[model samples]
Target: MPASVVASAGSSPAARVTIVLPTFNERQNIQPILQQLLALRDRFQLELIVVDDDSADGTADFVKQMAHGEPCLRLIRRVGRSGLSSAIKEGLLDSTGDLAVVMDCDGQHEPAAVAAALDLLIARNADLVIGSRFHPDASIKGLSDKREGGSVLANRLARFTLPRYRQLSDFMSGFFALRLDRCLPMIRQVDSQGFKFLYELLSISRGNLMIEEIPLTFQPRTYGSSKLDISVLWDFGVSIIHTLLLRMVPRRAVSFALVGLSGIGVQLLISNLLILLGFSFVASLPPAVIASACSNYLVNNTLTFRHLRLKGLQLLAGLVKFLVVASLPMLANIGLASVFYARVANDTLFAQIAGIAVVFVWNYAASSRFVWNTP
Candidate 1:
């Protein structure tokens, strides 16, 4: 609940605005983004809450050092758990501002756009304002085709699957702002288990939500690796499924199983490719099995048990536990699939689906119990 500010021009007080930065290994970009955001303190009351995942790069230490001088700066160093969506939620819950803006720590989001997005909340009475990269007047720099293409596909899928969100052109963009009073209730209610919290917000506020968008120029990251992977795609799919089957199943279990199902594709593709490259099925099997397990671990950590996500040494330790738990099921998957192939007459597709389904259940139960057991 730390709030800091520069003196406003008039005798009247400035409205509070909190910028929540959810970061992991973003030490290099931290100072620069802070400098930019700190420059805006004169115009509006600004507070910066950096919820970090215990970055080995000393991101939290640096923020603590900076906070000594900048009263508006606060750092929440999460030691055992980490996730972008959950980090944002932590920041939001701690924020004291009338308006809260969520942005990236990678410097991809322009700090300059924050004021304009905030203006929509204060003046235009917008329930939520998005800094849209796909806006007609927007520009982008250094965005990869793979990431951009994924964003496009995610947006399209969200629109097609959840028609209520069709009004948003950039459902995946992380930069956005809303009044704390308006968003806090929804944030508490939604399944905040995945990376795309904004999409979750939009989906939850389907009726009578006054949403607006402003053009924002997307820029390249100043430091750290992009978090995008096949797991992110799977997480997105799980979010869509969560939206579709809101009341039908336990969100975490369903999402975890869905991510495992996606990993089946990874295993099959890698194994098949190796076989095509002249490797024996025996030779290709181990790597394919391991790779699929790794994929599942990554996705489950980031999406399924996100609130209890691991970081640094804990992340590595969790992976080891995941592999140990997953190996048995991986073997079972091969055996079951083979058994189905041998017994079933013609429907190979059904056999494959049944095997995947069985393994999915096994993986989910084991992972939930051992790998990511957080209370």
Candidate 2:
């Protein structure tokens, strides 16, 4: 956390804001970004927080070398901390602004739009104000139809699936401003996982959602390849599921446990198949355990622990950690089942009851700390 995220945000008192930009590999666009913001600073002298997730293209360095103590402009060089939404969360935590505006660092999300969004937030006392491009008169430029359609589909799905969030044209756009406190608390409940921070925000948007389309062209990024991929798509799908299934932390954990149960079915099926094909009972167990762990990894990585990809290591470490943790439950099950089978010659049900209870705490504690942890 840097002081720019907060220290200078409300320094002016009259019109204080913290504009947070999440950047990833935008070397060629950083200068144009600063120039545009500097121009907008003439209209409003607000603090700026540039949260860069260790771009290999030297984006953070350019900002740091150029923007040294330039009053209201600061850059946070966050290494190992990746993803746009996660970067924004770091910025918000470090921010002290009454209003927080998050945009892109690729010179795409226009700086001038902040004026319109902030005006709406201040006048209407709105909880969230989105810079919509879907409005009829809005000048939406420089994007492919496919890219545009993807957003439309995702946001439409968001509104449909989420009962509380509705009537918003641009639910996926990162360019917007809102009351800092309202949006920040939702982070605790937010998945922050994968790429859709805005979706997570919209998922838990409890107060009024004020959507006003400020007609402005969306310029294409001038540098670096887009981070959107199959993983992003997978995460988007899981985000909706998580939002619909569980909207709170406790509810989310319970839902994950439910999903874990389904994983057990697949694991057992695979293990039994391997055993039927001439594998040892112990050998079959690894296949089943590994299969279940893999399934859990896919779902949890894409849905639960996505935002914490601060480092690539966290992903691999979490999986290895999962295997280590899963061993406890596996041993517990085997030991209980062996004793019961040997003594009563029956009562498999009794063993299952004891085994499940023991594993519950082991899985919960390990997953909470190593898997879907927020802080």
Candidate 3:
């Protein structure tokens, strides 16, 4: 133990923690890493939980051996499993501590950073305390231009689309601290699809989130190749879409409703363009409405009603169902407005109101019943 550690250990508060580190093909790095973690038992008073996803290289055996004599260490192997994000989810579901800190199994995330993250969480009451490698005060040693550029560009794009998370400079860093109850719901918001946990979390959490960029010297891993790649980037984009829509809508049929928004955009765009081309209000309205309806039909059929697509019969049935549902609103809009104007209400405002409300109920029910029937 370092002499400085001896001084701090003698004076500190306690927050019993369960440290979850997910691993795959990391046997050579396991024991040495656990040694460093064990040396800090007195520092943070943590229980180390190693979650290994059936690593083909006997990584689980390595952890099992190291954890045997160490009273604070325990091993949980998820057999026939692989994803980093899912492993952490499984670990948290099984963890005993009220607080859980997840860090990369690779040596890249320094063990000391975990201690720093915990302190920041305790002092500031931060929902999350991220160990940022790109912060000016950070002690990054082995970061290349490629890594630096990737981090910057990714965070910048995410900021533009997701304004709430933009304030955080280190959205991609996985090393962080959180109380487990708050952490569970945030983790569930993250799909099993991607490894970018922070990207997904920021989309849903409205808590008093204070992100601290604790600059730490990032050391390159001495053993094992990097798992980060293009898939991670693709997942980042997926995380953004899921996070944004999930927040805007409810679970029942909201994703389907969001798909309808694109149809609305296309509908308005085409209608305006046709009107600009010197078509009469009466003549232009039909073509504009027809064009928009056609576009909406195709989009909602394929994208919005995706969950209902299973067997050939199911898809065909769903298509028939969607057409009937979509047609009712649209027909009622122009038909009711045209008839009512000609026979009863001469006011254009009253006619337009009649059409809009007709379409609203029509679309809502069709979407609720026919389009999104999977859930």
Question: lDDT (CA) for every model shown?
Answer: 0.79, 0.68, 0.65
Q: Give TM per candidate.
A: 0.74, 0.74, 0.63
Off by over 4 Å in 2: 1-14, 123-125, 181-191, 209-211, 249-269, 275-286, 294-321, 331-361, 367-375
- Per-residue lDDT of candidate 3, residues 1-375 (tens digit): 222222332355356668888898988877777788776677566688888878899988878876678878888887644577777777777777656688888788888777777776666655677777767787666567898788888777767766765656677777777776556777776554353766656665653455655777788887889887654654565455655565554422343445455555665566557658876444544555556555555555553433233346765565566667767676777677667767888754465456655576457666556555533
Which prediction has more favorable lDDT, 1 or 3? 1
Which candidate should be chosen as best, given lDDT against the real structure? 1
On the 0 to 100 scale, the lDDT of residue 38 in model 2 is 69
| Model 2 per-residue lDDT tens digits across residues 308-371 | 5424776677777777877777677666655665576565445444544567656766776765
Task: Give the 10-residue window scoring lowest on summed lDDT in candidate 1.
Answer: 1-10
Off by over 4 Å in 3: 1-13, 246-375
* lDDT of each residue in 186-263, candidate 1, tens digit only: 888665566488887777776557889999899998888898776566677777877787536666777777777778
- Our tally of clashes for model 1 stands at 0
